[model samples]
Target chain A: MISRRIGAAAAVTALLFASACGGGYDAAGSANATTKVSVTTFGCEIWNTWAISKGVYVKHRLDVELVRSGGGSAAVAAVLSGAADFGYVNGYTAINAYNTGFPIQMVSGANVNALPPAKPAQGVFVGKDSPITSPADLAGKKIAVNEINGINQIVTASWLKANGVEPESVSFVALPFAEQIPAVLSGRVDAAQLGYSLLGNNNDGVRSLADPFASSNKVYIATYVAAKSFVAKGDAAKRFHEAMTETAQQLNDPANKDESFRLLSECQKVPAETLAAQPQNAIEAAVDLAALDRMAQQMVDLKMMQKKPDLEPFVTDFARS
Target chain B: MSDHGAKRSSLAASAQAMGRGVQSLWLLAALLVVWEIAARLAGSLFVPPVSQIFVAFVDTWLSGSPSSLFLSDQFRVDVLPSLARLGLGYGAAAAIGISAGILIGVWRPAGAFFNPLIRLGMSVPVTALLPIAIVLFGITSGMNVFLIALGCLWPILINTYDGVRGLDRTVVTAARSMRLTRRRYFLQVLLPGASPAIFVGMRISIGIALVLMVISELYAATAGLGFYIVSQQRLFRFPELWAAIVLLALLGILFNAIFAVVERVLLRWHRNVRPEGAEGH
Candidate 1:
């Protein structure tokens, strides 16, 4: 009986071995093929969400299925595991996955950080009476990020470095956005990096500290990514990119401003009034090489990666166009 | 002739023990070998080789000073915090569980009052109360402790209650006939009688406590095994991530082994009264 069980186990192992050695499966090869896009209900993913709600992909002769994956890391996982044809994820997440030998390639930009005069989407906040008046004061203090090794942390690290503060000096506590304000309020954390959506949630005791993304000249907040193998399949990537560009154009049109925010608020499950009141992000469809390179360099600086790879290869031509 | 017979049995027993050890470990060893071979052959970045994981584990957690007993700085920062929370939470649970259990067992009215509540507490997944815990305790270790203690309370309490309630009636009658004081009755008769069941509950709760510790630490934690795992996963350091997971498993085993030793020591008298494989009285 044991020998028979061993035989079955060996057979299973052999099958796994065979499958492992097989070539990558070609996906989205047919024109007008249904493409599964993993999206998160975040402000950055507004473009992709808008595209889906407005049937922009269908208009561009592409069938798109929007799979609501939670968070950037999950979206990256969805795309990498072939569970989705493409994913809208944090730009840093895509680059990090690529550096770690994943087959991910940036297909198009999702959202960009607003330049100075316009507030960035995210910022560090502290209690009104906090001793930490500026980024320099963050040294030797505990601060909260939504996730460690996430975009929040990376941006905070960048911002800290820009302000002559060593990122390592400040201890980073990982808390979900909902719990961050309470942590800060309760003196459990010295400060917290929070999005503008939660700004209304803060009471009179809260104060905005600094804009982390403001350190970068042009930061692509998020990007749509796909596996290199999937991107290589015919003109499916091109069609998807075209659809995203059209989506951006339509959203950017003044006539569609109210309608865009409504779609975004619906997609994100946030109050439409709150969404409209928030600062607008730069709507970018084409991936900017300089901005992408800057993010890769930041990852390298943060020691998240050994060295930045030549990102030219990981970006689709359609994304650049 | 008797001495010779004892020696022969001892030798046979040692041989049997060795055989059992090999039987238990062979599957694990085989699986490791298969995983190593399959991982190398597959060459997937996600599924790293076992050897790589071991190396990463040592590099990440074991590169420590001789003064710190070879435990890395990372261990103090990550693992020690988790252990502290687990200890506080588990310790609180055990103390409360045993006391409350005894109260419920000794006083039928109290038991009746708390019966439904205990059942409700046990049935609900403590993780579902994470938001409420965070609200009450903020993102501090208090939140983690509260969740862990709550999760571990039920098993220990239920088992102790069962142990106390199921005490032999003759023993209680004998204690009463001896004109024992209330304190003496509890110490000499009730405590020992119900200890076996109490230990059973505690043994079950150690696992529960460890689970709650990890779950609670997964969010709003600066330094913990869960935090380390999440950070490594986010960094896409698969080997390091696997190392943290393996460390967690080792920690669980270590806790179980420690529990076994304590259980053996505490229940030694009980074991002497009732030999292995003997029918229950």
Candidate 2:
């Protein structure tokens, strides 16, 4: 009995090893012409998934890989390390990397806040019965932000300061966007800064104190960035640019909302209902360079950056064209 | 002659200790030199010099006065909470693991029931459990502690069980011939026999505990050293990121050193009775 069991186990293990070995090789003579592009994988880095699902990448003849990154920093790091061809980054990160001479450039816009009238894509969400209603009430309250010095923290601080509340009075909690809902629900934090990408139920005993862009004028939040060397002078870069711009138009089009949402759900694993309730970002191809410049200056003013980074070289102005 | 022999041996031991210390220091110095040279050669912003990391560490952690606990706001906010969670989580795991190990190791029924479950639990990757842990425990220090304790429990438990099960025949006979009560047997013979293995398990758990500490913080933490590391990396503060990593490494070393000292003190008899190089042991 023992011998038979061992024999069967050996056979199974050998088969597994053989299959794994076979999976790694491709025939040399096989005519594989697709340009393999690697992009960051985030619910917010929606373009690659949307493009691939809707055959946009196929249309452009690019084999895009959605590389998993923890956040903007990791994504930028991936691009810089040659692990990714293109990666998602925020305005502050792009500006910071540019200043640090990381050879990364804003290839195209990834996401922006909902154009002023509709509530901003992010907000400070407090419990339904929590006493912290206005931003002024946030004084001496614990608010959760995704990263300590990232956009959420800056926005929360700005919101508090704007409302005549001392920024230092509010303690910022560093929680992932997924956990923010639970943190708020469990009362671990007084409020959570819910970014646009984080999927959460609307009726989960949470209400927004204020929409970020409701008061602020700027809208651009994230950018699709890549190393300048990779995109500076190549037909690949041009194809990527056109594919992204067209995909963005299609995603943003009201007629394609259902299809876009479907692709988003399939890719991000977010339910359509939850996504429907969440504040959608204004996805566009052309980055608003002025907004990005203003944000870079804001970081400098906040002492998040030592000095205002020169944004001219970072913005690839003619990439989309 | 015996007195002279003892004194000479003591002197030799002291010299050996000093030589070992110098060897470790030399290795560390060599590593730092290599790191400095590599950073200069690469000229990449990502790979800052070791000196810069040390400077960042001192600036971030060692700037405060002694009266104010000699820890910077960043250290007080981040590292302190992380250490506290690690200590608490490991403490729980140790207490439960030792007891559970004894129970399953001694009693055949408990071992039969729980061995499979323990095997299955250990096989599951921790990343898969993150969301479940968040949902079940909520995103608080409780959740962090629970995750760390869970990940750490297995090695300690399994090692202790093996230690008890593998007790020497002569030792068991001696323990029985002494006519010891159940409590006395457990307190004296069983525990002493298992001390070395328990320590080995504990050493393994400590590493796992540190990893889980960082991972738990990544999910949702207001203030943790791991979070600070991620935050710095995201913000393009490479020197500060390296500083946080160094802090984590120091914490690991500090915890292990403490454990080693405690193990040596507790298991002195085991070492004396059966040294590692001895044939039987």
Candidate 3:
């Protein structure tokens, strides 16, 4: 009887204790600021991080708070839900959001996929000894994608379609960028959609099954976004907007190249040596109008977009920033 | 006692029941009120009022034809898959956890062998196991189920082990004296005796199962609640995101209520024998 009483009391206490606890982010070693503008972020994509560490946001009179998001979709959600002031996403996500009436306008460019056609930014890789040699071979085999319906899926699908196969013929599993290489090497996933970070970080001798850029010939896949309402906050919006533009400018400036790569190297966990050798260099901040147009048109063709989005309302005229 | 005394006693019991009801719901109600008032005061587009969330819930999930099983097309494709994965994963975890737990608890050698492995498994967070599960099972529904089941297995196993290992020496001797067969002793005495602890583990595992379900679906999901939530968030569908969250919370509450009712039915004997004023409910 006494044991039962104790057990009941313990259970009640546990429940009460749990219920009383509130969820929060215990951010470490961050600057204490008067006002903090939170932006959703991923592990990599360090332009904004570069700007922040360089005191670029502080220069623009804003203290940027990096809120780690799950992925592109989660980032947008955080922005939409008022949990974040800005979100980083791909072009399709921005276009798709605009079309769906949950409008998010671009604040800055994150990175474009398949940039500098000479080297490109992403590839579909197989194990060094895998029999898979091309897109056709990927049929009936699982391919790890960062997101199922995101840019990687669209690019991979376009490549397969161009190679005389249906996109649905290949299975796309959601694997994080970091895990894609290991997953492919283990033979659980036959191929992985690998970005520059994953490629630079890969120690194992994994070979490209298909260069997605070579197969599909695409570019400009990513961007940063904010809710339309937030963007309409006039001067408050313009302050962050200028801050964002300035940050992107510095990120794109060749003068800051070494610092940028070091920051990216630290964030992406790739060697500084590897980053320096990559011909693609750091993601240029300029949003490519032609690339964005191609992406929107392609998404429409793939049925990934509801309608051809009016690109005017969705993007900032910051291409040359 | 006189008739007035009896009437007063009945009134006191009703008041106590009412107080319990109010006490249980107090925190929830307070939170909602705070949320609604703060949202209204702030007038932010991101934090929609709780009332708006409910309205969206109906619009998003309930505004559909029976062809889609009375769920919105998105819910049919997204929410149903998530529920299926959660159910299958949790079911497998409970079965394996109970059976394995009994093995570990009832047999000293099995306990000795599994203890270190269980401790190691428990020490590793469920999210950390996702990469391994993906590598082993690929990104199929099989991988999601594997993660959820593995994530839920530990608490159930540990609780059941404690219950079975702590089985009274007198109870074992009594069963032996009665010459009960192994199966009979297990079904009639062992399981019943261990059920309370098992139920506690089960209650805890349900929460774990739901968390893993979301995390697994967040990656490599073709259609699931997490996918819907993430997609909606990406698209800036604030109301819909909130709606999905509300639905998930309701589902959790409903599942726990169902478990409570089932536990009550199964453990009616335990409740009856439990001392008066010790109605742990």
Candidate 4:
């Protein structure tokens, strides 16, 4: 009788295992599914949060969940690890992810530095009392970036090269945006790459040393990414892309300025007046393929990767112009 | 006849030791095998097989020449800086702990004053003090060292105090009757009596120091095992990240083993403890 019971138990376990493997159910395939997106508090990710607050996702009949990742690398990890269906990551982070065999593709562009006549969205800053007058002085000094070998690091390197300094001469220290200013002020780092919102309205203790992104009129700052598997499975990517594109368009329209800043104020926790005073970077829903290709080459030149991985396959149709 | 018997007994002892070693290590070997099999079957990128991890570890950390102990440039860049900070931090903790412990243990007033404070300090998590440390020390190696020292300090101090307090009353009386100088009493009587407990504290502190070292290096660090691990993880190099993690585990084991040897040598005269190579009771 005991033997019969054990046999029955084993058969039941096999049946359960078979059932677990048989389903092709995906979150994107379900109606009224919540799309979880990983994002950071600053830069391009703020838009994702703003869209949620503005009810743009709801307009597209999508339920969006924004997960606050620490940084671009973390956001990429979240997407890759299935913690989120999509992540907003720095362009270089997405490129590095692709180069290293992570099956992630760009779903949409998040932000790019504005074409000059408008100040770039990011710049390297030094303490007000620092002796570093130019990019040339930064050759041997440590510079803080949100993530070392991230987009800021690459832009800094390219900017350094433009200034006749070898990118290898300077060291990149990884610090959070919150700590970067303090690091600069205390001389822990000689300079730091400060983003738009992080620069704040009253930047008293620090001075802008150089616009690192000024070297390229169209440096892709950040991109929205989804796992290749997720993009392939259903229309969730389609809906998300349309919603984000609409949000971007609305954010860019001068008529929507008051509404955009108000939503952004809620997302960033900064006053709407303060946000209005800050120069905004261009927000594009279409992935900048030419810019990413250039960045891939730059990664190769900087020896960050063995060779530039073809970025074409990684940019999905929804992200295309 | 006696010599022949001695030889036979020695052979049996060696065989027994071999068996014990195998018995102790078999579980680890079995676990590794199981992990390898499970990982291969799963075919997940996150959990690569053990063999791949081993290869990655060697390539990432042991690809240098024989003269340098087969240590790679990456080891010098990452591991050595971490070891420096750890050594400084642990050394500071040991010095401060033993000295302060002696004072607190011997002086009733001081002990009473510090007891509650030490309890409170020990209860507070070290990671929570990270922001304060950063504010006080900036994001330099100084901050890392300060955190490590703080984390390691409590255990060593408490253990040393216990060791001092636990010393035999007879020994204290004897030292007093001999009229030894305060310095002489501390050196000859109090320290030796309290050493075993002090060693216990130091041993516990070593692990804390290592954990703090990793935690500190995770932020604003240009080079260190923690930084290397985070970078590799970000780059999606799972094997390399796993290799760094394995190296950290090995470092932990190596530190404990070194501490064990030191304790054995130092505490050899204390009969209460079991000595290595001692025959059956």
What DockQ does candidate 4 have relative to the true complex?
0.44
- Report the lDDT tens digits of candidate 4 across residue range B74-109: 999999999999999999999999999989999989
Q: Which pairs clash (backbone N, Cα, C closer than 3 Å) in model 2? A: none
Off by over 4 Å in 2: A1-38, A41-68, A140-148, A171-179, A186-188, A195-205, A234-279, A319-321, B1-19, B24-27, B66-70, B107-109, B124-127, B181-183, B279-281
| Residue lDDT tens for model 2, A57-175 | 76776777778887777888888788987777766777877876788888887677776677567778888888877888888778888777777777667667667887878777777
Interface RMSD of predicted model 2:
2.3
lDDT of 1 by residue, A123-207 (tens): 7999989887999999988888888888888988999998999999988888778778878888988998867767666757788
* Top of the candidates by DockQ: 1
lDDT tens per residue, model 4, A200-306 = 53388888876888785577777888889988887777777888799888878889888778866776688988878776788888887888888888778887789
Q: What value does the interface RMSD of model 1 take?
A: 1.5
Residue B165 in model 4: lDDT: 96
Off by over 4 Å in 4: A1-26, A30-46, B1-11, B178-184, B272-281
lDDT of the candidates, in the order given: 0.84, 0.78, 0.76, 0.83
Reference contacts reproduced by model 3: 0.49
Clashing pairs in 4: none
Off by over 4 Å in 1: A1-27, A32-44, A129-131, A185-188, A201-205, A268-273, B1-13, B275-281
lDDT of 2 by residue, B131-205 (tens): 787777655788888888988888999999999888887988998998999999999889988878998999999
